[model samples]
Target: MLLRQLEYLVALARERHFARAAEACHVSQPALSEGLRKLEDELKVLLVRRGRAYEGLTPEGERIVRRAQRLLADRDALREEATALRTGLSGTLRIGSVPTASGAVSLLTDPFCAAHPLASVQLRTDLRAEEVLRRVRDFEIDAGITYTPDSTEGVRTHPLYEERYVLLTGASEEPAAHPNVTRPNATRPNATWAEAAELPLCLLEPGMQGRRTLDEVFTGLGLAPRPRVETDSVASLFAHVRTGRWASVVPYAWLHVFGVPPGMRALPLVGPVHGAPIVLVLADRRPGPVMARALLEVARRTDAATVLERLP
Candidate 1:
């Protein structure tokens, strides 16, 4: 059983088409087919279902595919370990992050890169919490930055910060235009959840975990927010809030990073100060890849709480 044959089998399972799988593996279709046939003969098990078109993998093939994924991950980890031993840590550390955690990821990566000058980082911020966990479990990402308490069964988590919600409003708004606020005092820097819910709002879409947390908080407070604009992108929300007519409730850390976006003001959301713990999650494998281990070490030493507190 050559590793190349296992690679072909895994590719076929992923693509579900022999021709596409062969293309993915960068080999001719006949060569890939012959490799699979040899693998089946050596293992004494029928791996692929024979047909004119590409049939799905057999039951035994499914089992082997799972094993193949682990084997490939371990092989890569071994290579990373060897490289680290020879000359410091040096590899691409892939990270998946939920939208709300995007602002905080640099807290980990910036220091990691500074320490290991040869190491590189790739950060993907479009993932939901579930998708982050899935990618980490599948070895697609080295780690993730996501919210806590959504079932982290096969992963280890390092708590980075607690994401607190805030009410953001346009700083230059007229008194009459802000009819939602009964108080209407520019001096009052804090807004209750009920008060913030009364404005024409732009919020994250309901499918996102950050939005779900907001929904839960609103439901608990007996306030249902009907946002005028909904988006999945935090940058879009920020842009809309900068228009001087729309308001939003978002993580306070965002304001810390982007610095109130010129004409916007972020007020503490009162009456139900809810916070979600954001964490760095990695697969629960002992002696993980060197890059992952080095990144975690940086995360461990980061004073994220102090940095957030000192943010204006």
Candidate 2:
């Protein structure tokens, strides 16, 4: 019914303990309890189920809580935008990046920091596309770098670049030993996908968008790569592949992030290599001055994947 009631309800939903939730809201237990009751009565619904202690929210309450949180977050962001307009660019800009886009963050960060030296840029990595959307809607993150825009209404997007998949392998000890590979062609140590797939493979978890993309390509080529190791973290996969015990499918941009470790080799995913579009996503509403400027600068300077021409 009231903003304070919605705030109390959110705190309770998060903490699930009356005393702790009350403390979080900077109110006494009785005050929080009373506020919730008033809200429930006004809504004419049993928002929270009853029990000896603080129980979970009712199904209806859960739905309301999610919408309420988004509304509250958006309202606060609007206020921040107004204040920031007057103060100039000097505040936090939170960004979430998926594993493939992790390498792309630096492309934006360096230029953004140079432009707004006083503003704070906070970067979070390993966010999935869906998680990025949830955080953006909740105002938890200002923007995200990820695969092509997935049509989340109320979110704006700018294409960062196109990402092409690449195959990486541990440095071959006996390049000559594998007849499948041409004798060290200097370019890639001259390895092909067929040769690369022969090694142990480390791949992203099945559920990840990156993995699915790679799987489609492999399946289309009739290449069945049985991963010896599977993980959700791209960093972990790269680390394993770096040891030469495993091979991996990674974005060409990531070759920069993981670097071509001493014996590591990266081969383009030939046989109809796929190029998926990547984009920078932000809430549709106006962002704070710092975030708005940074986003603009990133869009202006980053050709993102256009630079990948240099990769082998």
The list of candidate 1 runs beyond 4 A from truth reads 12-23, 46-59, 175-184
Write down the lDDT of every candidate, Cα atoms only. 0.86, 0.75
Worst 10 residues of 2 by lDDT: 175-184
In model 2, how many backbone clashes occur? 0
Which tens-of-lDDT digit does each residue in 1-312 have in candidate 2? Answer: 488999998888878899999999999999999999999999999999878997799999999898888777767666656666787566777899888778878888877777766678888888888888767765668888887755768677888878887677665655432344332244543345564455567889888778887777677777787776899887887788666556777888887676676776777766565788888887776543347546766777777666666654
**Candidate 2 Cα lDDT to native:** 0.75
Which candidate's TM-score is highest?
1
TM-score result, candidate 2: 0.81
Could you tell me which 10 consecutive residues in candidate 1 have the lowest summed lDDT? 175-184
What is the C-alpha lDDT profile of model 1 across 1-312, one tens digit per residue?
Answer: 489999999889878999999999999999999999999998999999989988898999999987887788889999999998999888899999999889878888889989999989999999988899988887779999999846878789999999998888888647424453442356886889998878888999999999999999999999997897999998888898777778888888886579877767888888978889998899888988777888889988997867886766
Q: What is the lDDT for 288 in model 1?
A: 84
